[model samples]
Target: MMLFGHGDGGGGPSPAMIESLRIMQKNVPGLPDVVADTPERFFKHAASRYSGLPRWVGELYFELHRGTYTSQAMVKKGNRKAELSLRKADLLIGVFAQFRILHQNAA
Candidate 1:
């Protein structure tokens, strides 16, 4: 019985990681089911949570208006010190909605 991440170097699942997957599924069932078994999932799920994406995914959303980013790679890998904080996905979605409306004149 191979787990989803067996191809990698035997990385065990983090509870936080699994929770991210569940959150993703609950909100965006239409996208491909990608679990937190790899860096791609971590980046994507974090991106979704942080970025103000409107039912859309990919690089373009990262560059678009209303999108804010907290790069996991930088926080995890870089030397910059910053406070660790995050808004839940539901709150972020509402915030994004507001951002879209407020910034409609600029966008």
Candidate 2:
């Protein structure tokens, strides 16, 4: 998958964000190989292969800074829920490890 971010730091996307995307694609199963490039590079690539392309590719805009002071309660609740989920995941991991060890010993 080719994800076009404004390359060379033209846009707000930092190098760390690009690297994180690469790492996620690498570690995740069934995820396509991701290539992060500038808009100019993607446009050039599309132009070179114009015949096989669609009429238009959609655009997305993200507002990184939004005033959310009113949603503090919601944010806190979400954080609490996430913490509970992580605790549950930790417990499951411990159980899985114990099971694995037991199975190995039995074998």
Candidate 3:
């Protein structure tokens, strides 16, 4: 998260995000792509279970911002809801990211 922001000082992605993705993939073993990238679709598909999400999470989405807001504490990474680093996010959204590039397909 810090790496996504300009003010966290030093840069790239946090180690935690990387490991989180590894674990999720490890656990699920080839999770699907279309399922992860389209959260609205996911939310609707699982509405009964997820309609309770905070309004912000359901309303907002993923986008890459290059710099921090100079005046506001809303650092480049601030106020992000479904936000994930592009690297982590690509993987988090699953199958969309070719982390290992070892296989042409992953679930």
- Order the candidate numbers by lDDT, best to worst: 2, 1, 3
Q: Compared with the true structure, what per-residue lDDT tens digits does model 3 show for residues 13-99? A: 567856655566554757542222345655576777777766554534345444334545655445454365566766755663445
Q: What is the lDDT of residue 70 in candidate 2?
A: 53
Candidate 2 residues 1-107, lDDT tens each? Answer: 34545753558656887678868767577876666667888789877988676665565544653444455778878998999999998888789888774444544
The lDDT per prediction is: 0.56, 0.70, 0.50
Cα RMSD (Å) between model 3 and the true structure? 15.9
Candidate 1 C-alpha error for residue 33, in Å: 6.9
Query: Which of candidates 2 and 3 is the stronger one according to lDDT?
Result: 2
Clashing pairs in 3: 31-107, 32-107
Judged by lDDT against the true structure, how good is candidate 3?
0.50
Q: Which runs in model 1 stand beyond 4 Å of their true positions?
A: 1-9, 29-107
Candidate 1 colliding pairs: none
Error of 2 at 7 (Å): 17
